[model samples]
Target: MKNILVLCTGNSCRSQMAHGFLNQQLGDQAAIYSAGIETHGLNPGAVATMQRAGLDITSHTSNHVDEYAGIDWDFIITVCDHAYENCPFIPAPNAQRLHHNFYDPSKFEGSEKDTRAAFDKARDEIKAYVTDFASTHF
Candidate 1:
């Protein structure tokens, strides 16, 4: 099975959404994990966003990139520039690294509707990318 890791500044939002989408799309075809350069726990907005799309990430946990040091990954994807720029060295010798900055919904603090919209937009973006990634890679 392909081993894939989705990384971001925090394990809270984008990466978590990507992890859920990839896992939902790829199923048993891959082993998926999401981590952060610094763990910021899970984002409720992210969980709710995925739930609206019928994917639940409520059980997911925030993780440090160092946690998966032993796994030989097939892909290492960064969903934000912060993680991409500041990522710690990982021993995934054969992993293909991909980068895409997904908007952070938590940063949008205007109103509940606006925040939800941001999360929804990000969810759609992540889902599209993941569907294509799974189709091409898995």
Candidate 2:
């Protein structure tokens, strides 16, 4: 199976959402993994946002990019600017690198409803991107 990695500043929101959508879209066509330059644990907002769309991401974990080590990656997607700028060399010699600066709902300070709105927006954008990614790549 093709190996794909989705990365973000923290393995909490954007990358996690992307991971779930991609997994659903690609199914057995690829192996999807997500990690952060620095692990921030899974975001509850992200999980709840996705659950609303029928994808459960609660079982996903926050992981440092270093955990992937030397696996040959087919695609390396950075979902935030921080990760794109700070992540070190990925050992996949021919991996396709992609970047998308998705909004960080975790960085927002707001009431519960407002926070959920932010997460929902990010999740929608990520879903669109992943749907497109699956059609174009797979």
Candidate 3:
């Protein structure tokens, strides 16, 4: 099974959503994990968005990228630009490093409903990317 790690700046939003999408899409065929350059616990907006999609990430806690040291991953994908810039070094040979920067929905300044819409949009984008990858390769 290919191991995939999703990374973001705070480990609270983008990376966590990517982890849920990958696990949901690929199931046991791919092992998935997520971390951040710095830990900031779970984002409430992120948890709410995932739960709305019928995925529960309540037990998922934020973690630093260093927590993944020595773990071999086939792919390391950064889901946000800040994470791409702050990524930790992974020593796995042949590991493919990729970046697909999605705007942080949490940074959107708007009404409550509007902010939720942004989160939903971001979640859908992640789902599309993951679905394509899983269907073709995993």
Better of 1 and 3 by lDDT: 1
Local distance difference test, each candidate = 0.91, 0.93, 0.89
lDDT of 1 by residue, 32-117 (tens): 99999999999899999999999888899999999888999999999999999999888778999999988888888788888899
Preferred candidate (TM-score higher): 1 or 3: 1
Candidate 2 lDDT over residue span 51-133, tens digit each: 99999999999999999998889999999998999998887889999998998988989999898899899899999999999
> In model 3, which runs have C-alpha deviations exceeding 4 angstroms?
none
Error of 3 at 105 (Å): 0.8
**Residue pairs in candidate 1 whose N, alpha carbon or C atoms collide under 3 angstroms:** none
Residue by residue across 6-92, what tens digits does model 3's lDDT show?
Answer: 999999998999899898888889889899999999999999999999999998989888888888889898999888876767787
Ordering by lDDT: 2, 1, 3
TM-score attained by model 1: 0.97
Q: Estimate each model's TM-score.
A: 0.97, 0.97, 0.95
Candidate 1 Cα outliers beyond 4 Å, as residue runs: none
